[model samples]
Target: MMLYYIYDGTFEGLLTAIYDAYYERENPELIVAMDNFTDNFLIQRRYIDTDEKKATKVHNGIINKISEDALTNIMYAYLSEHENAGKYILEYLRFGFKVGRLVDSYLSDDRVHNIHKLARKVSRERHLLLGIIRFRLLSNNIYYAPIDTQYNTACLLGDHFAARMADQIFVIHDVKRNYGVFYDKSKWFISDIDTKGNLDLHEKELFYQELWKKYFESTTIKDRLNPKLQSHFMPKRYWKYLVEMK
Candidate 1:
């Protein structure tokens, strides 16, 4: 019987779950953010929460067993949040287990190639959001931005904005994920914020939104419009946060 391990959707939590699974004699399948069994065939499943110590241990172990690049690739794949991330990780780990120390050379393998490709895509999206995200100044001197992302990228983008906008109070909402980053001009924190309640635009903010929408519509060339190309560059999922579209 294959065992199942569930984690709390953090990289550290996943590592701790991996540490738990490693002690077992039988290899098991690991999953995150799932509570139900697919087949109802009496599968043994265990849930693990984030543990910094256990995660550090597992991370250190992986570094000792494989190269740093392997660990980075695995972390990138984990961040992708793609449907097949767990299976992709399993394939990567299997390759690592067989090759022991030379698995990095398997970058050409289809499984490894896909993981790297997903990582690059997610990275690019996060980078674009960092430079392109616009914040509206609220009445209380707080800047706010709302976003909907296909990946869990709020934490990553938070670091970038916090450093650049260090002198101002700001919050960035990942509307799709129901979480956001709040920076009070000194420190930053992440929390679950309901966009419906917090994002009621004030008159000034509304005016800016209107002006941005007009600018966006005005900038488009009728003869040069390519819906497919535009969609590929700026996916529909993120349009909710784009000031130009709003």
Candidate 2:
């Protein structure tokens, strides 16, 4: 019989389910988010609550027993939010606990391979967004940048921007996910924003954007233009957010 551990669609919740699976000694066929779980009487499903203590125990256990990098890999995989991401992380951690730090090195195994791929995918998007994100000055004197990303990467961008633009008030909004990271001069945090109306940009921001677009146009030589090569470096999916591209 296939038993599914259904969690509250949170990382901690998923970890708590893993903790239950470990202590209860029940092998769940799949650990699914509540939103993903279907209503079916034939399926044996257990709803796991987000328990901080149990989740922390599993979190610390992974760090102390396995490698710190293993924990990071798990975080990235979870942030990937792929349908099978939770399942992959559970299997990856199970293997990591048994073999210690060398868990990721055994990528030849499918359990190890899938988690690593998801982590890499999220990391790659984070890296690209760091370069591609364009911030505009707003009427409230805040720097606002909106992005539409495939993965949940808005939260991952805080530390990088917080350090780079230390003195500025900025918000990196993931419009697709409808959440963003707010960075003050001192720290950064994530929250939702009101995106119902048009953005009120500073008068100078429009001038700056136009200037940037003109500069790009002036520098371009039609004879030497290679859009394919340009898009190779800067993916077409992100062009919609770029001032010059617009």
Candidate 3:
């Protein structure tokens, strides 16, 4: 029977699971999220509860022993929210602890390569979202933008927007995840947001939306229209939030 470790799907929980994997010597075939676990007669499942101390110890060790960039890559991979992200992080750490900072140089190794691939995917989405995200003026005077992303990237955008729009109050909501990063002009943090009907747009925002749609139509060259190439660059998935795409 193959052993599998399961956790609550948080980054800290994943680190705690790794701590157990190392200290208990439970050589599991996979590290999986509790919600994603599949019951199988041939697999032995071990549940790992999130412990801050143990998680912190492992987090510190990764930074102290391995490179800080390794931790950043691991965090990016974790934010990917991919099914295999936890497993890849475990394998990456196992190899990293042995080779120290030089572990990143082993791109030929599948363990190292898997993490880099996930991180790159997440980084790409973050960069793209920064350009494509559109904010609307809220009735409460806050700026709000809703996004549905492949990876967990709403929180990743907090720093960039906060720096650029320092004097503005805004919220970047991740529709799929049901959470947001809110900025109050001075500080920002990730927290649960009310997604109900209360988020009414400011009166002028509706006019602005209409104006943007008109601008899009007016600027288009009908004779040279190429949706295939447009979709390739803009991606169809992001159109849901685009006011002009409506």
Candidate with the greatest lDDT versus the true structure: 3
Q: What are the per-residue Cα lDDT tens digits for candidate 1 across 143-225?
A: 88877777777778777888898999999988777888999888899998865555444559878778888888998999997
* lDDT agreement of model 1 with the native: 0.75
Provide the overall lDDT of each model, using Cα atoms, as 2-decimal numbers: 0.75, 0.90, 0.92
How many clashes does each candidate structure show, in the order listed? Answer: 0, 0, 0
Superposition error at 164 for model 2 (Å): 0.6
For candidate 3, give the lDDT: 0.92
| Candidate 1: residue pairs that collide | none
Model 1 spans > 4 angstroms off: 35-39, 48-51, 64-68, 97-102, 194-203
Assess every candidate by TM-score: 0.81, 0.93, 0.94
List residue ranges in candidate 3 displaced over 4 A.
none
Q: List the candidate numbers ranked by lDDT, top first.
A: 3, 2, 1
**Candidates in order: C-alpha RMSD to true structure:** 3.1, 1.8, 1.5
Q: Cα deviation in Å at residue 93, candidate 3?
A: 1.0
